[model samples]
Target: MKLRRRAGLFAILAAIILAIAYGFMPKPLPVETAEVKRKYMRVAIEEEGRTRIIDRFIISAPVAGFARRIELDAGDPVSKGEAITELEPLRSNVLDPRSRAEAKARVAAAEASLRAVKENVHAAKASAEFAKKELDRLRQLFKDALVAQEKLDEAETETRRTAAALRSSEFAVEVARHKKAAALTALKYSAAREPEEYAERVIIKAPVSGRVLRINHKSEGVVNRGQPLIEIGDPQALEVEADLLSADAVRISPGTPVLFERWGGDKLLKGRVRVVEPAGFTKISALGVEEQRVLVISDIVSPPGMWAELGDGYRVEASFILWENDNVLQIPASALFRYGDGWAVFVFSNERARMRKVQIGYRNGLSAQILSGLAAGDKVITHPDSSIKEGARVRLRKERTL
Candidate 1:
């Protein structure tokens, strides 16, 4: 009876120990994954920049004056030869009265001198004619031997002296006429007239038909010569000015296609590289590093109606298409992994993670072109974690939580 009781107790302890071990056993954790879909991909470099009009004009003050009234503001339409701004004539209350009086007196004096010289010329001409006639009579008398040679000689000398006096009077007349003309010209300058005078209050006109972009002068003020007053540009004609690194600029050529965006538009605008400027300048980046920058001028390929809402100096983003390929198999950049000397990816197969090495082509920030080792409809792990290993059995979750 004792042996039978001991056997029953040992059997109960063993059964209890087996039940506790079963409850402490681990359960398989679920994992999520994705399939690799083949699609066309593009590799692009993005940059932040601003929009600009291809042809911009800076209208400046032709003369210094108080910029009394600016007839237009930014975005105002102006026609060719239109008056955009009016400047008040600079008036000075301190004009010397004696200066005006002296000018008038000089004019009168010049006129009087001219009249006197004319009279002198007339008298001299008459005297010269008389002297010539007297010399002819004396010569005739000498030839006929009716007078002494000495008397003929005296008459000849007197005629010569009168001819010299007449010539002197003629020169004096010419000098006086020139002086009078000069005095009249000076008088005209003193009385400055509108449109004819190159002085203050010069009307600045628009050289071309366009919209006003900037107005530097706000109130009535004086501007020096050659100072900028306003900027103008054609609203219909617009282009983008891109500042590219010098190294990248060398690879870009004219006629290359470009994609533009964020110029106050929801859709991307198309454009072409029109010009690559030969000059380059130094520019400091946001990190305070100095770099050489080159300007590239591009023409908007999109219709004018699309960009009509855009104004001058609007900010825009541009992407230059250095190269492109169509119908190429590609995958997301996250799906790739560096294995040994080549690239590899985790391809889902047989309900487990399979390690497959892949040959990669061109790779951008977003996608990578798969040359081999991957095909369309292959499920690959995008976000791989250390817990996942090669040949590890995985159950495809219905939803991708990551």
Candidate 2:
């Protein structure tokens, strides 16, 4: 009985030791993982932009005038030379006595002065010619001693005085003629038809064919010179103006491919970089942080059928294609981790998370190109568990939907 009792105790003790050892064994950590994928990911720089007209104009008043009539409203389509607005002159009635009588009186005064100057000029010319003939005759008689020296001197002096008087009279006539001409010009100006009388108003014509985008003058009143009247643009000539950080702008150049998304449209519009502005401006972002930004203009190359709903000034999201890869090994950017100043990925080995050192190449926001240390169909731990170590056992959970 003693021997049998000792054997039973030994078996119970062995069972207890085995149970304790099993409890202390390393447990497999549950981790979420995904198979490393290879996709054609384009490296891009994203930015905010707005649709703009390729040609835009802001019409302004060329002269100060009252807005007597407005023939078109905002959004109206206008053709070149088409009248858009009109301004009437301050005075409209030319038949009124106050205007007609004043003009007639001025005309009569100009005619009278002109007639008087003509008669005076004719008389002065005749008198000057007669004086010259008399002086010539006296000089001949004095040379032949047929006339007294004092008499000849007196004749010459009289001739000279007559010539001076004629010249003075001629000058007076010329002055009168100039005065009459001035009066006549003034009268013509007074009798001229006012702008309203001719066109009934000053017509504001469209300088170019376009759709009016905005009308700054809302009421019929005076609009000062240079004051904005309306904004016009060609809807068909649409482009995008994107604002990018200075650092990103430097990498962009003309002819680079671009992808554009409208504010609410699901379709992506393809475009090409047209211009990268050389200038930069400082702007305060929504977060109240000041940043230097540059404008990049791109031309939408996608057929209008794709972006028919887009309009000028509409907001959009643009991605500038900086680089691209095809049929290459790539993984989620989050799958990468820092391994002693180099890049590494958590890969599955023997159903456990293993830290595999890797060499990385070009990458974008969502994915990184694997230059080395990874292969297709490899399971990579995207959301690694904290309890999982390099050699620890792991249980892989299904990937969650993005």
Candidate 3:
């Protein structure tokens, strides 16, 4: 019986010791883990972009004239040399009473000038006729040897002078008549301002084959020379313009591959960078942040049919691939943490967290290239908190609740 009592006491003491030890032992930390693997990795800069025509032609008014109402709407197809607009003579500006009186007086004065020129022409004709008669008489007398040769020459010279003076007077009459007519047209234009009143119209034609993009003025109105009238561009020829932050722009150069998305198309449009503009401009973002941006132009390399509907000023999301690798060792970016002037990760091994210093190469926002210290199939803790330390016990986060 004493032996049996001793055995019972020893069993109770063993149970108490085990309970105490269990209480003091460190608990395995619940951690999310990811595996290191090989993947086709790409480092890209993403930003919103816009689609624009490769060559945009802006048709402007060729002269200051009254434009006919634009019959073509935006998106209307146009062929090269097709007449798109007709410009009539500009409507006269509203004339004040004083100006109107002056115009009327000018018209009267031009009429008077024309009448005076006609009288002068008539007088010149009379003088020419009399001089010709005298010359004919002198010629008869000279032929009969009854007049001196010098006298006949003088008569011929007077006849020629009168003939030339008559011609000059006739020319002056025509000029005066033109002046009078111009003054009349100006006076009449104030009352008559219709398309039919204009003698001729200036027809503006499309310089290239394309669709009309914008119509600056649709209604008939006076347009000045060099004023933008319509914008035309070929929709099939598409290019992308992405405004990237200056810092990101420097990392990319010409020939960088680009992918366009969310541009109202089913296929992913592809392109290559054509130019990185040397100049930078200040832009205000939606967040009201002042950002220095550079324009990166890209040519769409895909077939025209893929993005045929895309026209100027269409929005798109552009991904500029700065670097790429066919197959690369990579891990979740969250798995890495700063460690002593380098980088480190807590690798899950044998149910414990093992701190490992690693060399990393390229890093996208979501993933990083593992240059060293990590291998394929290695599991590492991601989002490690302060509780995680070297040699600490850990378990797959799914295995337990927080």
- Provide the overall lDDT of each model, using Cα atoms, as 2-decimal numbers: 0.78, 0.81, 0.91
Order candidates by lDDT, high to low. Answer: 3, 2, 1
Q: What is the lDDT of residue 170 in candidate 1?
A: 84
What candidate 1 gets wrong by more than 4 Å, as runs, is 1-32, 65-68, 86-90, 93-201, 324-326, 385-388, 393-402
The better-scoring model by lDDT among 2 and 3 is: 3
Which pairs of residues collide in model 3? none
Q: What is the Å distance of residue 258 in model 3 from its true position?
A: 1.6
Per residue, candidate 2 scores C-alpha lDDT tens digits across 30-83 of 777767767787899998899999988887887877775555777789999887
After superposition on all CA atoms, what RMSD does each candidate show versus the true structure?
6.7, 7.1, 5.0
Please list the residue runs of candidate 2 whose C-alpha ends up more than 4 Å from where it truly belongs after superposition: 89-201, 400-402
Full-model lDDT, candidate 2: 0.81
**To one decimal, what is the Cα RMSD in angstroms of model 1 from the true structure?**
6.7
The TM-score of candidate 2 is: 0.72
For residues 85-195, could you state the per-residue lDDT of candidate 3 as single tens digits?
899886666668898899899999999999999999999999999999999999999999999999999999999999999999999999998999999876677734553
Every model's TM-score: 0.65, 0.72, 0.78
| Leading candidate by TM-score | 3
**Cα lDDT over the full model 1:** 0.78
Candidate 1 lands at a TM-score of 0.65
Which residue runs does candidate 3 get wrong by more than 4 Å?
A: 1-21, 94-186, 192-196, 287-289, 399-402
